[model samples]
Target: MKTIKPILFFLLFFFTISCVNQKQKDQEEIKQTVKNYFNAVKANDLEKCKLLIEDSENYLGVIQGEFNFLHKNYDEINPNDVLLRNILVKDTLITFTNEKEKYVQYIIKNDKNPNNLKKPLIITFMFYKPVGYDKIFNRVILENHIGWDK
Candidate 1:
C-alpha cells in the first residue's frame, strides 16, 4: 500500500507538469502565429496572411475589405508599428457553434499612423483554437479609433 501510494502520487505529479508544459508551449505557438501574421501584414503579403488563417474563405472578404481600406486611407500601414500593449488568453464558448475554444486577444496601441490623426487607434486581433485543434485561427480584427483609455 505504501509503495502504491508513492507511485500514484508520482504519476499525478508527472501528469500535472506535462499539462502545464503543454499549455505554455501552446501559448508560445499562438503568440508566434500572431507575430507572423502581423509580419505578413507589414510586408503586405496577403498570401502569407491567408495561409495563417483558418476558414479563410469565410473571413477572406472581411480581411480584404480591411486591407483595401487601410491601403486607401493610410500611405503605408505597418502592423509592426503598432506597439504591443497587452495579450490576454481566455477560454470561451462559441455560442453559435457550441464549441469550447481558447481565445488570444492582442490589444495593440496604434501610434504609427502616417496620416497623423489625433485620436488613438486601438487595434485588437483575436485568434481562437477550437478544442482538439492544434492550430490557432484568426477570428476577428477590431479597430477602435476612440481608444481604450476610457
Candidate 2:
C-alpha cells in the first residue's frame, strides 16, 4: 500500500509536468498562428490565413474589405496604417478542458491607427483544440470593430 501511494504520486507529478509542457507548446503555436493570421490579413492574403486555420472560413477578408472601403472613401483612413501590436490569449476552462480545451479567446490589438479609427479595430478570435490534435481544429472571429471618430 505504501509503495503504491509513492508510485501514484510520481505518476501524477509527471502528468502535471506533461500537461504544463503541452500548454506551453499550445501557447507558442497559437501565438504564431495569430501573427501569421494578422500579417496575412494586413497584406490581404486570404489564402494564407485560411490555410493557417484548421476549419474556418475566410471571414477576415470581409472585415478587411470594410476597412478598405473606409480608406477609399474617407481621406483620413488608411488600411495600411493599421499595425498589429499585441495578441492576448486566454483559455475558456470549460467542462471538457482536457478533451477539447473547449475555447481559447484571442484579443488582437493594433497600434493606434491615426486614420481617425480610434480603437484601430480590435479583433477577437475564439479557437478550439480537439482531443488528440496537434493543432487547433476550429476557429471563429468573435469581434472586429473599428470605432470611427465620426
lDDT on C-alpha atoms for all candidate structures: 0.58, 0.52
Scored against the true structure, residue 94 in model 2 reaches a CA lDDT of 51
* 9-104: candidate 2 lDDT, tens digit per residue: 999999999999988787767767766665565566756656665643545565445435433433233244333344455766456545334333
Candidate 2: list runs displaced more than 4 Å.
Answer: 54-85, 93-120, 131-150
Alpha-carbon lDDT of model 2: 0.52
Model 1, span 35-128: residue lDDT tens: 6766566667777776776777788887776555444433333333453323455677779988766665543344455454545544444455
* Model 2 RMSD vs true structure: 6.3
In model 1, the Cα lDDT at residue 100 comes to 62
TM-score list, all predictions: 0.66, 0.55
Query: Distance (Å) between predicted and true CA of 46, model 2?
Result: 2.2
Instruction: Give the clashing pairs for model 2.
Output: none
